[model samples]
Target chain A: MSKNLHTSAPDTDTAIDRNVPEFPVAQDSDEQNYFKTNQPPSYLDQLHKSTKEFIQFHKDQGKGRKVVLVTSGGTTVPLENNTVRFIDNFSAGTRGATSAEYFLENGYAVIFLHREFSLLPYSRHYSHTTNCFLDYMTEINGELRIDPKYSETMHKVYKKYNDARDQNLLLLLPFTTVNQYLFSLREISKLLNLVGGRALFYLAAAVSDFFLPHSKLPEHKIQAQDHNGGKLVVNLDPVPKFLRRLVDSWAPGSLITSFKLETDKSILIKKSNQALDRYNHQLVIGNLLQTRKKEVVFVTKDPKIEPEWFRLSDEEVEKGVDIESLIIPAVIKVHEDWIKNHE
Target chain B: MSKNLHTSAPDTDTAIDRNVPEFPVAQDSDEQNYFKTNQPPSYLDQLHKSTKEFIQFHKDQGKGRKVVLVTSGGTTVPLENNTVRFIDNFSAGTRGATSAEYFLENGYAVIFLHREFSLLPYSRHYSHTTNCFLDYMTEINGELRIDPKYSETMHKVYKKYNDARDQNLLLLLPFTTVNQYLFSLREISKLLNLVGGRALFYLAAAVSDFFLPHSKLPEHKIQAQDHNGGKLVVNLDPVPKFLRRLVDSWAPGSLITSFKLETDKSILIKKSNQALDRYNHQLVIGNLLQTRKKEVVFVTKDPKIEPEWFRLSDEEVEKGVDIESLIIPAVIKVHEDWIKNHE
Candidate 1:
C-alpha cells in the first residue's frame, strides 16, 4: 500500500485568516477562518431574509415570548463536488421534531432547522419508515379523504399545524451538507442575539465530526481505478469548534443546550462533562443510543449539583409515553432559572 | 503519511471461496463468491415468502401474464457493523418507480424492489422533498380532506393504486443495504426463472460499485480521533459483478434490461457497450446523470442499427411528462419482440 496526499488552498479572492497556529487551537479563529475559506449555500440569503421576517413578526407582538431554535437530523459530508458519494451520519430527526412540538406547546416560538426530508413536527405520527403517506388516504366518490382509522389523530395534528402557522410561531429552515449546517447555524445564532435572554438554542443535529476539506478533495467524482488494490485514503479535518463561540459571542445571552449521543454508556456522562467544561455551555444532555428513547442524563454548569437523570418507567414505555414529554419540562425549569439569574 | 493495512480471514463458519485469483477478471465468479462469503440479510426469509406468494398468485390465475421485477434507488455500503457512517450513492428511485407504473398499465404484474422511503409508483406526484404530506390535506368540518387543488390528481393516483391492489398486480419490496439487495436480487431472479420468457427484469438501481467488505471493517463505529492527522483509509472491493450470472444462470430465459448512468457523455455508450459485451445482457439504457430526466439512449446487441435516443418534447416537458413514460413503452416493445423470437 502507498500513501498519496496533497493539499491546495481554495480558489477564491476572499482573504482567509492565517494568524492562527498550525492545527488551530482557538475556537473563534477556527470558525472565522472556516467561513472565510469556504463558500456558503446559495440559498443562505433567502433563508436569512425569511428568518428575519419571522423574527420581526414576533417582535411586533410585544409579548417578549421565548424563541427556541431546534436543530434536527443528520448532516452529510460530500466526497465530491458532483456528490456521487457522501458520508452520512445516522439520524431520523425524531428527537428534535418531537421535542419541537412540546416547545411550541409550552408557548415558545419555534424555529426548526432540519435535514431535508427528515421527520417534521405534527407530521411524525403519520409518516413512519414503512408506511407511505398515501396509505393513510383513500378516494371516496372522486374526493380524497383520510382513512377513517387515522382521521381523529390526523385532525388534531392538522389543527396544531394550522394554529402554529396562523400565529406565526414556527419557522422551518433546512440543510443537507455540513457546510450548509455550519453557515446556517452561525446566521441563526447571530439573528437570535437580538432577542437576548429570551432566546434558547437546542442544538440536536448529528453533525459530522470530520470533513474532507475543499483543499483535499477533488473537483469531480473520485475515480475508482486510480488506487492500487482498491484502496481509497481520505484525510479529513476536524470540524471547527463553534459551540464555544456560540456561547461566548454569537448568542451570549441565550441559554444553549447541546446533546452528546454515544453508543457506549460508560463514557457518555464523562464526555458530556468534558464538553461542558471546554465550551462553558449552559447544559449538555448525555444519552446512550440504545436506551435514548427511555433515559437521558443532563449535565449542567454547577459543580455542586450532580448530573440529573430522566427516565421513563416500564409502564410508561408500554403506554407509549415519549421521554421528551418528561425531558422538556425539566429543561424549561432550568431555562426559567437561567433567565431570572441573567436578569 | 503511512499506509496501515493488514488482511485477515472472516471469523465465521461461512466457506468463503478464496480460490478466485486475486481480483478475478470474470464477473460471475466474483458474484458467486461474494454471496458465498457474506452473510445474507436476516429479512431474506420474509421477502422470499412474499415473492413466492406473488408468483403463486400469478400462477393460480392461469392467464400467463408477464411479470416484471424493477429494482430502484441506491444501496448503502456500511463501513461499520453498528453503522454510524456509511457511503451513499446518488439516486432517488424515480426511474424505477415511474417505469413500474407504465408496466402495470401495459398489462404486467409488477414487483417493485426499492430503497425504503424512496418514491413509489402512484404516490410520486404527491410526495415532494420540501413539503409535508399534511400540506396536501385540509380540515373541512373537522374531517380531514385533500386540498381542492390536489384533489383531482390525488383521485386519479388513488384509483390506480386501489385497482392495482385489487387485481393483485403489484408487489412492493424494499432494501437499503447492498447485502440485502444482492441477496434479494438472487432470490427474485431464481424465482422469476420459473416463469421463463414471460418474466422481465428491469435493473435500474444505482448500486454501489465498491464496498468496504466485512473483513476490512470493525464491529464498532470508526472514531475520528483514533487516526493520526484524522486520515481514514477505506479499502473497498469492487461490488461483485452479478449481471452476468443473472443473464446466464439465474433467470436465463427472462428478458433483462439494465441501466448505465454516467456523468461524462463521451464514454457513456462505450461503458454501456462494455457492460453488454461482458455480461451478454439484452439491453443497456445509457443515461447522463444531469440530463437523465430529459433524454436517454438505448443500446442493444445489434450494432448495425444506430443507438435510439428517447427525448421528452419541450411541450410535454412543460406539461410534466416523465421520460420514463416514453422509455418503458419502447423497452416493452423490445421485450415483446424478444418473447416472440425466443418462442
Candidate 2:
C-alpha cells in the first residue's frame, strides 16, 4: 500500500537509504537480544521510583490534564567504560525545552528527561549559553538584583518557573550515556502507560544510531599509542530498532511523535514518511539541521493526507516567537483526534 | 639529567608509556603543517579583535597587575566537517575556574578561555549543574530573590562577580572545537606575550590527543550504513604537542604550568615528570581522575627538589575547602620566585 519507498527523488543520492540496515541486516529480534546482553543502567531503580511518584502525584491531583514526556538533547556513546572520551551528537535541547514550555502553557504537565546540563524549560532563558549567569544580575544599592535591562524577561521566566513548581507540573530527569538513555526511555514509557490515552511522547533527543556495546569498550581510557599507524578503528553495532517495540509494547496507548533530522533538502519528506510507515507512529516531525528553528514539516501515515508545513514568519522570528509554540498546538490537535478515534 | 623516567611502580603495566608515539610518529613541524591544512575557524577574526582589545585594556591600566590566561574545560575533536558527531574529553572545568578565582583574589587580571557553557569563575556557584537554575531563585510577594538558603554563599559569589567586572579584571573567550581552541590558544598566547614576563599560563583544559584531519573528514554526516560489518575505522593523526612551541617560542618568558591526568596511579608521577622534561615548562600538576579535587602532586624540574604533594585534609574536605586555595598559594610563591630570579 505504501508507494514512496523508493520513488524518484530530486537528488542522485536517493538510492542510499542511510537509516536502513543492509550489511549483516539486523532484524527486530536483535533489539531484544541487545537488552538481554547489555546490563541495565545503575540509575534504573532511582528513575523508576521517581517516575512512579510523578505518575501517582498527577493521578492524585485528578485534574485530568494530559501528561507529555519530552526527551531532549543528545545521548553520548562512550568509547571506554571509564569514559575519558565519547562520541556526542550535536544538539542544544532548544527545540525540546522550548516545546516543553509551550506544552506546559497549554494545560500539560511535563516530564522533561534531558541530557544533563543541556537546557531546562523555564531556565532556558538564562542557562547553557555563553552569557555568564552573573551577567543577568546587577548590584543595586548594595543588593543583588536582576539587571534592569533583563528584568522584564527575567520576571516572566521566574514567575512561570515558580508556578510550574508550585502547581507540580514539571518533573525533571537527566541522562548522559546512550545505555542510560535506552534503559530510562523504556522504563519511562512503561510508567507513562499507566495514564493510558493521556500520555504523549515527544522524542526529540538526537540518539546515536550506532554504539560500541559496553562489553566491547575498554575498561580504561583508549590509548592513542595503539592506533595502527595513526588509524583508529572502532566497531559499532547498530542500535536496534526500539521504536517498533516502543509502539507495540511500551506505552502502546500513548500518542508517539518522533523527529527526523536531515542535512539534505531533497530527501527530507521521503525519509520522514518512511519512518512514519516503519514505526507506525502517529507523527514524524521533520527538520533540517540548518533551518530547524525556523521551519518543520509534519508527516503523518494516512495515505490520503498531504504533509503539513509549520513555518515561522520573518516578523515572528524578529519578535522572538518560538516556532515550538506553533508546533505544539498542531500536535495537541492530532493527539485529541487520536484519543477520540482510538476510543 | 632526568632520573625518574619510568621509575619502578607498584604495577607491572607500568612499562607501557601511553603518551609515547608508537604508531606513525608525528613530528613537531607536522603541527604547523596541520594548521595550514585545516581552514581557520570562522570566528578567528572576532576572537583576534577581542584578544587585542583585552590586552590593550590591561596595558592601559598602569598597575602592571600580573595577568593570567587560564584555559578551562575540555576541547572537542569533530569527526566531520558538518559535525553531527564529535569525540569529547572529560572535564567540567572546575580546576581552571576555581584556580582563576584564586588568581583574581590574589590580584591577577585574568583572561578566561573556556569551553562554551562550561563553568565561569564567580558564576560557578550556580550554573552547569543538574539542578535547574530556577531552583537557586525564589519569589516572595511578587519580588524575585535568591533563595534564602543559598543567599549567603550567593551573596559572596555575586559581590566577587561585581568586583571582577567593575574592575575589568576578567575577560572571557569561549571555544568549542579543537581547531578553534588551537587557533585561540596560539593567538591568546602571542597576545599575552606582548607583556613578556608579567604573564602566567595555567593550562588545565583536557585537550584531545587524537583527531581526524579536516582534509580526511567527510563534508556531510558520517553515515553508519557503510560500516564494514559494524566496524567503523577512523584514522586520527596525533595532535601535535604545541606545549613545546609554547615553551620555546610563544610566550617563552611566561611561567607556564600544564596538567597530566592519569587513571593508573603508578604511572602518574612518571608521566608528569616526562612532560616537565619534554616541554621544559616550569611545572606539571599531576592528578588522578578519581581524586583530582582531593589531592595533586606538583612536579618541578630542579633535580634536588622532590615532587610536592598538596592534599586536602579530611576536616578541610568536610568543611568544603577547595584544594585550589592551597594549590594557588604555592603556585603564587613559585611565580614570585621566578619573577625575582629573572629580575
Clashing pairs in 1: none
lDDT of 1 by residue, A1-343 (tens): 0111112332222111112112223456677789988888999999899998887777678478888999999998877776767778878899999999999999989999998878899888766557766788876665678888888888888999888888989999999999999999999999998888888989989997766676555555443332234434344566887888898898999999999988767668777887887788989989877888999999997989899999999999999999999988988888898889988
Number of the top DockQ candidate: 2
- Candidate 2 lDDT, A1-343, residue by residue in tens: 2433434333223211233332233365687778888888887899999888988888778566789999999999887777777878898999999999999999898999999988889899888766788887777777777778887778789888888888888989999988888889999999999888889999999998877776677676554453224434444567877887889889899999999988776878987887876788889999988889999999999888898999999999999899998999999999998888776
**Per-residue CA lDDT of candidate 1, range B248-327, in tens?**
89999999999988777876887677678777988999998788999999998898978899999999889989898889
Per TM-score, the best of the predicted structures is: 2
**Candidate 2 DockQ, CA atoms:** 0.34
Error of 2 at B262 (Å): 1.2
Question: In model 2, where do residues sit more than 4 Å from their true spots?
Answer: A1-29, A224-228, B1-28, B224-228
Which ten-residue region of model 2 chain A has the weakest summed lDDT? A8-17
All candidates: CA RMSD (Å):
7.9, 4.3
Candidate 1 residue spans exceeding 4 A from truth: A1-27, A226-228, B1-29, B224-228
Tell me how many clashing residue pairs each candidate has: 0, 0
TM-score against native, each model: 0.90, 0.92
